[model samples]
Target: MPDEVRELAGVPVLVCDPDGPLVATEQDALDLIGAAFLGAQVVAVPANRLPEGFFSLGTRFAGDVMQKFVNYRLRLAVIGDISERLARSPALRALVHESNRADHVWFLPDLDALDARLRAAS
Candidate 1:
């Protein structure tokens, strides 16, 4: 599926579906950012759309990916419950929890939750 731009509470967001290309790296994220003029402040992508490396702390892919978004001043919402991954790694679970607590990144169960959070932030 193709990525689309959506608006929530006056903010334009880029919503990437699970069937879309994998966003595994900073460069891939930059490509998504490039799709819009001036870029989007927030992006909603399925958890499965991310690369496997993103779930492994030893790989540092999660940190790198998050840093990339931070550098661009963009917030990311990774949707879906990664229960299996969280169960396998305490570190990953902590990271997810911490990211969710921050304003810059969030891990949501669905688009409706993302929309609700965005609405509350506005």
Candidate 2:
């Protein structure tokens, strides 16, 4: 499946494929704003499917991805378990914490948590 768009808490969201694009470069990140995510308020991407640089605080991939999304006024939810990666990088851990506290980008545990967050926000 390319991607599936579903409604959660009255919000349209596109749940990305687990085996889909590995967003390492700006081009990879920009691709999300294409046809698949049109009219979707949130786009969910699995942490495992993202490039390692996406989790690296010093890497441009993460910033570039977040910037593109913010510019387009799109919300992003990064789902899946990232405990190991978080453990290895304190900076990333801090960033995740900060992201969770914000409304734009979130590092949620899974799709269920994403649903809960959206529901709670409503």
Candidate 3:
């Protein structure tokens, strides 16, 4: 992560546009988020360029991330066009539906909406 990215942490929201294997490594992921809320009230990560297996690893990795966020009480919004995943996994669809009902984790379709939601939450 760069200094600019760390600066984002101080803002009210953090929109991430990562590339390659950054999302695959937990340290990289956390580092990217370390400064997302620099001094703001809330943060949101728009995972547009996440590596493969992030959602597919829903049973494992997703669950782990979700738990970590929940434990830290950090709100996260997964912004992506996840229609395919939703169609393939009924369980994932159910989880999305359930998560959407909460303020912490949201599976949104676009970044604008994600920003709006996070801004509203903050």
Candidate 4:
């Protein structure tokens, strides 16, 4: 991840999938978000496979990530199939919808669409 950041001549747009378990805490989420924002415009994390106990902590982390992005005015996009999340949490789904309505946070279905959105933003 560090190497990818260093290799970028300009801001990069990171594409990632949540293949492993979801993060456990706000700090961990922040760390990953920070890593992604390093020389990057967006970070795409998979929609499924989030931590089993992600309700409260995940919400907090999402809030933190939003604050960080607002503070720095950085852009980010979370891409993948979010049906699982929607099925589990209506609140989270609402949040995703609202975020996507904004200019910064986006919930897309695939990397290609994400890339298109980022390019459009730029």
List runs of model 1 lying over 4 Å from the truth: 36-39
| 3 against 4, candidate with superior TM-score | 3
For every model in order, what is the number of clashing pairs?
0, 0, 6, 0
Candidate 2 C-alpha lDDT tens digits along 20-91: 868667777678777445678899988877988888878667878888888988899999999999999999
* RMSD (Å) per prediction: 1.5, 1.2, 3.8, 4.0
The digit string of per-residue lDDT tens for model 1 on 81-114 reads 8899999999998998899888999988988898
TM-score of 1: 0.91
Shift in Å, residue 8, candidate 4 = 12
Better of 1 and 4 by lDDT: 1
The clash number for model 3 is 6
CA shift at 51, candidate 1, in angstroms? 1.5
Tell how far residue 107 is off in model 3, in angstroms.
0.6
What does the lDDT read for residue 45 in candidate 4? 59
Runs of candidate 3 exceeding 4 Å displacement: 1-11, 18-21, 40-43, 57-59, 118-122
Ranking by lDDT: 2, 1, 3, 4
Q: Each candidate: what lDDT? A: 0.84, 0.85, 0.62, 0.61
Evaluate model 4: give its lDDT: 0.61
lDDT of 1: 0.84
